[model samples]
Target: MKASFAKFVILFTVLAVAGFSFYFLSSREEPSSLCPQARTTVSAPEKDARMKNILAPTEENIQAGKALFNSQAQPIPCSICHGFKGDSIGVIFQWIKPYARNFTCFQTMKDISDGQMFWVIRNGSHGTRMQAYKKLEDEQIWQLVLYLRSFSE
Candidate 1:
């Protein structure tokens, strides 16, 4: 009986160690498979710098923007998570775990500047559910960005 009990203890220890090792190994893979980019900043497309010329989100632009943002361009209704006006969730989560930023809040919006928002929307946030829309047309993305500006006001 004693011998049998000793064998059970050894088996249990071996199983526990194997289980933990498997968990650790699998967890090390990271959320994304792509290798890390050396640069810390987001890069721009190889197009005309005219992308910068677009400013002023007019009412007509806003209306157009709204359509662009709401459309099923990818998978989700951006406003659903960002809030109706996009003004509460914030662009970055300060303390919350994987927080979805509220887009309607203008205070945070102004801080990001147009370029940053365009990059994030186009590239999507890594380590999060945000997926880059590399396929979206430049005009469509601009329109969406214009609509997003309305949330800041």
Candidate 2:
């Protein structure tokens, strides 16, 4: 009887260890670069024919956009949802069902035009965590667009 009890205990211990090992191994970090980018069927509203990027993609403009994306000055910094790397793996994405946009994916971003992106930024995307940056000037949004374009490049 003792031998049977000892065998049962040993089997249980082995099973528990194997279960834990599998769980931990599967939980390893998944880089955002490898994750699938956000795929949206929703069409961005058309932009005004005259609307265009007022700020050139200069070093200063890019820096300003980067700062805004990382800072909480206005619109609470895009990094909160888009991630610091613009890979859309922000901390807030955990609660968001669809997740945020992964800008690194060229396939998804190729279809998005500058004007469409600008409109989305200025007027938040529907059914997503994105919020409208009505407080930010158009030029500031354009600067952010310029910064976002770099992620795919």
lDDT of 2 by residue, 27-73 (tens): 53465544555466366655542366777889998888898888943
lDDT of 1: 0.58
Question: Which structure among the candidates has the greatest TM-score?
Answer: 2
Q: TM-score, each model?
A: 0.55, 0.72
The count of residue-pair clashes in candidate 1 stands at 11
List RMSD in Å for every model shown. 10.4, 6.6
Model 1 residue 74 CA deviation in Å: 2.0
